[model samples]
Target: MKKPLLIDLDGVLRIGKEPSPHVEKFFDLINTLQIPSCILSNSTLSTTNDVRQFFEFNGIQTKIPILTAVEAAAMYARLRYRRVAVYCTDHVKSLFRGLLDYENPQAIIIGDYGKRWDFETLNYIFRKVREGAELIAMHKKRTWKTAEDGILLDVGPFVVAIEYATKKEATIIGKPSELYFASALSLFNLELHDPFIMIGDDLETDIEPAKKLGAETIFFNSEKGFTQEAILKANPDYVVNNLEDVIKILKEKF
Candidate 1:
């Protein structure tokens, strides 16, 4: 069995507020095999612990902790900058409480800013970065899942917009971010090359990044199968339709 499995939350195991079917079975596999695993998500809508609690309440329970982009940002922000300007929902912004600096900040931490992504607000953040504040994006994921809207534009688009206007790059601290991946693996006492696998929905942020770390990646596509070109582009070790299919792959490969 894999020492630790890195799993993404949204789209991979759940969409919006609903947990995907067989999510409990997925956790059961890890537990039955005595494999260590943790939940990882790019969304900063809640703290890692909050996400875990949500999972337990919804039907999945795991002793393992969640590795969230917000927590990663909080850790990095505490060490790197004393004062920073943050852009995200109220729940997410709470992660940066003591470190926030609205005026003349040292860095600008951005996440799912939701309805405040208009031109005027973006330009205001641009002004901060232009004046020498570093940009720390939670993640560059392109889409966000919603119960009502299905999939919609996510923070990646807005972050890119600000980057273009300011001619500055953001330091991402979530999925696909090497440091973030490394940080999650560390919790399991596993290094980059250790025996592990990543199971997630996003080709770019989930499967692609795990491949970069030299770990086996299982791409969780929605339809019956992924395009051959998409398969070649992602080069995922395996692709499955849902989390339930992972049981067979683990039995075969691990």
Candidate 2:
């Protein structure tokens, strides 16, 4: 049987607000091959439904399951805390419907606040954490790329700042976190050591964690920054330049 696959959505299938040129063909191959797979995105700004709409909007339709950091964080918050104050963009605030408590919260869930992250706002969150509210970060990605804006700071740096002030680590709920990876794996009823393939662009968040979890890694060498030597030293099982190349690798190998 073909191995289960864990796919990252952002750089692998989409870039910025647009779908990658070969994304449709890649999903088509995955569907034809009937690969047991799950689409994982560390996008705190988008929900699973939003991602589906994106593909549909781009005229590429498929029924592959999706799991985003926002959904996972909501699931995590609901299962643990009752009165939770979710600090995210208005787009995804509804995910934590029943747990929205800003006045007196038992837990503070941080996500992509975008331009709203100022000293006063961060200080408020810091005070809340110091006051005994558990801090849960949606994802700790240091930066993200945009089609127009180049690279911008993500929520990780803010999460780390709060951690620094509070002297406590926030429970990370996205990529590279074992809990996040395990949650995605569980969708296929697969465990950490199960034979699987991970396709992603970011080495730190996507490749490294999956490699540690025993997945055969495929580094999607789409973005710049890493040297050829750096990629080789990271030692992914396969490195492909595009989604077309990814299709080739899967057809030729797994």
Candidate 3:
């Protein structure tokens, strides 16, 4: 019997540049128990390969599949729009290398650029949009925590800027979008009722979407229930203080 567990990256497994406490023990337990797991992150910063390297660097042995919004967006672009003008950090830019021409792109894809956001980039994107280019965004998260600031701006504001300039909405490819969820599930060849769990820190992006897909959900509370109010509205199956609690529940349930 194969039990599927979907885990999020940011707050549940790591925070900023540091790995979460007990993450190593958690992975060891998974190996010891022989439980199958997958990492499904909403982050658009890194590619799936990069994510795998991060886990390996942290000494967490992960053979399970890794799905990220960047991969999802790429899949979406390949299916919908082939030639795209991307507005992402250089790290993320490397993922789409050779996929886009940038000479006369048909679409504008936006993601978090961190400190690289500036007037020059914005003007370039705006120029493309004015020329009738379509817009696509990874996720609409307003802000995310970083080592430099308590809360750094995310891709949401940039999406808003483009929309404000061009008056055209972006096709979202991340959480709250059923396409991404479906793509993740397809990788496991599992159905909706196949004893699956969604574990993440964000209530709206991770928990609600998984619940809508008929999967049981676990919220990894990071900000002391800052999202609890919204999560209670959706009514997840379980809520935990950290990933350790998630492991405990799996042990009892499975």
Candidate 4:
């Protein structure tokens, strides 16, 4: 049987609001070949359905479900905490539903707040943690590539700052967490021994962790800041320049 494919969204399918030129074709090929795949992201800015809508609007008709760090965080919060304080964007905040209670929260969830992150906000979150709120970090990505703005700061820096102030480490609910990968695989009834491929850009969060889960990796070198030495350290099964090249690999390998 052909291996299932797990693909990262940022720096792979689209950057910022712009999908890559090869995106539509890539999705079509996946559908045509009947490849069992999932669009996985550590992004907290959008939900799985929102990603689906974005892809459809960009002309890629896909039935592929998304697995995001936000979803994982939300799932965890539902089982663990009843009331929580969200230090994320409005869209991400909505994922928590009834659990969101900034007044008196049991946990403080951190995600990408972009410009919303400032002295007052950070201090407030710090105080909350100091007051005994459990710190829940969504993901720790350092930076992300954009279609227009190039590289932008991700939530990692701020998450670390909160940790520094509170002296309490957050329970990470995203990539590099074995639970996230194991959960995704279990949903599809897959085992670690099954032939699988992971195509992503981030080495720490995407490549290395996926490898630990026994997935053969294909590092998509989406030009932000990757040195040859870095690539050597990653040592993926394949290195492809663009999404088009990834299509060829699927045809040849799968």
Which candidate tops TM-score?
Answer: 2
Order the candidates by lDDT, highest first — what do you get?
2, 4, 1, 3
Model 4 misplaced regions, further than 4 Å: 147-149, 191-195
In model 2, the Cα lDDT at residue 197 comes to 90
lDDT tens per residue, model 1, 1-254: 35588888887777667888888887887778777788898888888778878887986787766888988998999999999988888887888888888887999999888766788778888999999999999999888767676667888998898899889989999878888888988987777767678898888888887887788888888642447798789888887887778888876755
**Residue 151 CA error for candidate 4 (Å)?**
2.8
| Candidate 3, 1-254: lDDT as tens digits | 55677788888888777788888877777777877677877788788888889878877766768888887887777777668888777777776766686778988888777788889989888889889888888888777887667777788889899899988888888876777666766767866545667888887788888888788888887862465467679788898887678778877876
For model 4, how does the per-residue alpha-carbon lDDT over 141-205 read when each residue is reduced to its tens digit?
A: 88866666767888888888889988999888888777777767765798755667899988888
Candidate 2 lDDT for residue 162 = 93
- All models, RMSD in angstroms: 2.0, 1.3, 2.5, 1.9
Model 1 bad stretches (over 4 Å)? 223-228
CA lDDT for candidate 3: 0.79
Clashes of 2: 0
Each candidate structure's TM-score, on Cα atoms with residue i matched to residue i, is 0.93, 0.96, 0.87, 0.92
Tell me the lDDT of candidate 1.
Answer: 0.83
Q: Give the Cα error of residue 146 in candidate 2, in Å.
A: 1.7
Judging by lDDT against the true structure, name the best candidate.
Answer: 2
lDDT of 1 at 147: 66
Q: Compute the lDDT of residue 183 as modeled in candidate 2.
A: 87
Scored by lDDT, model 4 comes in at 0.85
